[model samples]
Target: MDKYAIIKIGSTQYKIHEGDTLTVDNQNGKVDAEVLLFSDGKTTILGDPTVKDAHVKIKITGAVRGEKIVVGRFKSKSRYRKGRGYRDTLSELLIEKIELGGKKATEEKSIDEAPKKAVEAKPIKAEKKVSKKEPAKKVVKIKKPVKKGTK
Candidate 1:
């Protein structure tokens, strides 16, 4: 509930907030490009460290250059000393808000489709056939006199 932002500048992700300035390792975006940061793609788990696709508002403070270094290739007595100034393009950002995206979509759909789902008149009652089981009848036995001799 404490308003925070998940911002992605280039391939690096940052968790930032209002007035909280942070530097990204790389800078490959415009000053204000809509970038969505997520704990994961599913849009759940804010502080799960994995983050979601929730787009946050940011104002790129400015792009800064890093330090300098020397990049020279020369022989010992050949006298070759080449120094170069290299500054990395670092972007500073201030996190504004972690937009609540799904809230509106879900709320709108639920409200609009509620009546449609309820009023979709199905059959009032289902007609099912019921068969009765009957018990099997036994045959009656009749006693017969056996012939004593070879009649």
Candidate 2:
């Protein structure tokens, strides 16, 4: 069973696991997030606002901009119209590990582990070109039958 926890960053709450990446409201400097709840699949711990001695370690990766939002205002019979667009500044965070009951669950690999090598890129082959030709049309001429006495 995997371990999971509910944590609060700013005013938002997120359910996260070790090694997960999160995008939330911009955090100035370091963030001291609070752990709301925690579960280790077998055991569950609840907090009255926050858990005691439990910690969730996170690293701020970078800052990002959220999707643009358009805001508009219009007043009837006033000939007044306004429109604007803006994006919220957001921050990206990586969950490093979670600690509970003096035990730590780490998502990062140890320095003794060997690093993986990058795979070599394969060359792309050119596609075969095809020429399209229009098919010939057959024309059939229909002759009206001659009237009995007229040619």
Global lDDT of each candidate: 0.56, 0.87
Model 2 residue 85 CA deviation in Å: 1.4
TM-score each candidate. 0.43, 0.63
List runs of model 2 lying over 4 Å from the truth: 77-79, 103-151
Encode model 1's per-residue lDDT on 1-151: one tens digit a residue. Answer: 3455555565666566556777765545544333343433353354444334455555567777766655766668878666666667777766544565554221235445644455576777878989987988989999899879875
Highest-lDDT candidate = 2
Provide the global lDDT of candidate 2 against the true structure: 0.87
Worst 10 residues of 1 by lDDT: 102-111
Model 2: per-residue Cα lDDT over 41-80, one tens digit each: 9988999989875788898999999999999999999999
Collision count for each candidate, in order: 8, 0
